[model samples]
Target: MMWTKCLCLLWALSALCAPVNKQRQRMLLISFDGFRWDYDRDVDTPNLDQMAMDGVKAQYITPPYLTITSPTHFTLLTGLYVENHGVIHNMWFNTTTTEKKPYYQTLFVNEWWDNGSLPIWITAQRQGLKAGSLHFPGTSSSYQGEVAMVREVEPILYNYKNETAWRENSDKVMGWFRDQDLDFVSMYFGEPDGTGHRYGPDSPERQEMVKQVDRTVGYIRHLAETHGLTNSLNIIVTADHGMSNVYRNGLVEEITLSAIPGFSFRDIAFHLVDFGPSGMLLPKPGKLETVYSALKGAHPHLHVYKKEDMPEHLHFAKNDRILPIILWADPGYVINGYFPVQFHKGEHGFDNQEMDMKPFFRAAGPAFRKNLEVGPFESVNIYPLMCHILGIEPEVNDGHLNATRNMLVTSTGTRGENRSILQNTLTGIAAVAGFLAVVFVVVTSRQILKRKRKDKRSGSVQHLPEEENTKQTGF
Candidate 1:
């Protein structure tokens, strides 16, 4: 009885230790570049509106520091913030080189490339899954040993050149699905955003581009479904930042950080140049109040915040990368290019609440429950969500799975509980291994019995041959 019990225990342990058959799940993430939240609600986006109605939508999505393309894009892929991931800015001004390299230029550099720590693609690949990216920022060269299809920004994306490029881009993305099973595919569209910046957000030209983008989205959906992806392919549409029209009238105030006494600025908002719009100011000892007072006097429309006073939701204070002073721009204002003279029609990278700076998120897929609005979410949360859906582990994400849990299909029941899923998976694995062990023992016993039977037959034939030898002598 003791032996039986021991054997049973061995079986259970073996079952638990059995290898699991890995599954290949696929995901498709699409960034409509500059598609604003307002466009889905206001413009003719029948397909996109249906997507929102049938999918999960997040009310607000916050960008990581500087709220620029490279940093935010890296965050989505790696699940780390700008400070942690180290992309830092859209266009990094290297003081050492004294030459500016667009973020894409650093794609091949080992420091930033492999240092991402836990990029979504690398994580997926580690698990034996496949991923592909098309024309998204920060993916131009490769990272974590994955190369994505990426293109540099061109002046031509601003106007008529945009339509041709966009069509070509969409076609290329659609072609990727042919004969290939991928775990993830990411594509970016830069026209509507580029148009919004050049032609103003509310302009007729921008509105038309919005319509064009809608058509492109419809085609993408069609291609996804026709390829039998159906709802299995998760589609996430989001933006790096929102846009606000910066008028010449708004530039009445202008002041450089150097002009202020005992205050230093590594970077300042261009719109609030005179008063230093939405910025971080490191003040010399005993000069905080003086700098704050002078800033307020110089720019009354701006809202100033101490590091401790920043919004509780931004998660800003504890990290040193965030400068001591945070600046907020008044609605419809953004800072732009270098000193003195300049009038610009477009800008982003401002405080989260600026009318033109709010980002929206909409996601739909087999993993997502139909017709759900997801959050009041930050962009940081996106990294983890991507990892979860792809079945990859994330290493450096500040965001948690709970942040966007509502979008998941199993989010409500026992499956919705992550702990339950893990527990059940382990249980199933153990059961399978135990069953296999018992079958192995049975097969081995049968083979041994068959061998013994064959040996007995041969022994009987040998004894008969000895009798035949005697008969030959008698005959």
Candidate 2:
């Protein structure tokens, strides 16, 4: 009986710590780079609108601070802030080696990626599930010396030509799912981002690109239905960051480093410049104060900060890779260095708290709840939700499942309701065990009392034969 009680306690503990089963069979994660949160509102996105109506939609999803391409996208994959993930900026610069790798050049380098946090695809693969990547950043590189099973790291030039290119990529993604039998897959489309860069966000060209990407969305839906993967697969559509117009009255605001009076561009030991909205300035030996003073109040639109004095909310200043001085441009502004001034019509990599920097998030499939319009959430929380759907345990990350768990549904029920059911089950088991214990004590006491009463009644009158034998012995 003691062993039985111990067994019940052990069972309860096991129930509390049980592993989450795979939420669904397949997940297809798609990214539309620089697709603003409000783009669908301005343009006709019937397919996207229908998906929102049928599944879940977020009003907006805020990217992490330093809202750039590589950092935010990797944050979504790894669930870590830029300071922790080490993709501090789109471009890579090694302070120790004095090596500067351009933004596009770092795409193929393995060391530039492979931050300590594992992306979802790599996590799935490590857990014995097959995974694939189609031009998604960080997927090209190996994690802990292991790569995805099926990967296409071709340059972005090959993938984003026009509407046809998007459709072809969608077809290939579907093929990988159907023919290759992959459990997890990621795909990327460089759209409206490039278009917005060429033409301002409000321009007709950007609107047309929006429509083109919408068509691609519809085509992917058609393929999923045609191949009978609609119900079996969970499709997530999101973006790295949103685009903001940078041109005003036909003039671009370019902040040139050479224009600063006190600082010389030659004195800079390592300079990562020409990237819009944000750049890092490392001064030569004994020139830190001079560089900071030169750029601190030089421009009306540019905001400069010393590494240690950076805003606490940004979570950027703690890393060693961050240069001595950080420069940030206000919305609709640009930052430049010794390089020739070229104006892009639109730009990102600004303060993520701004509305213009927020991105779109929509998802549909068996795992997500239907007809739900969730409020805006941080992009870091996305990693945990993806891990939950894949049924793999997430690594140490800054995200919380509670932030997005309500958007998902499981076979048991909504995740929250399923948790409630488990809690109730454990409670009910405890209640039953407690009641049984009380009943055993009561029944045992009654039996003992009955025996005592019978003995007392017998002791009150001796048997006739026993009395006669006692009298004979006395005589």
Name the best candidate (by lDDT): 2
TM-score of each: 0.71, 0.82
lDDT of each: 0.63, 0.82
Q: List model 1 lDDT by residue over 12-61, tens digit each.
A: 76565544443334577777665666766667888777787777877767
Shift of residue 96 alpha carbon in model 1, Å: 4.2
Error of 1 at 165 (Å): 2.9
Question: Which ten contiguous residues of candidate 2 have the minimum total lDDT?
Answer: 410-419
lDDT of 2 by residue, 241-307 (tens): 9988885554754577787788798778887778787888888999988888888889988999989
Worst 10 residues of 1 by lDDT: 268-277
Residue-level lDDT for 135 in candidate 2: 80
How displaced is residue 116 in candidate 1, in Å? 4.0
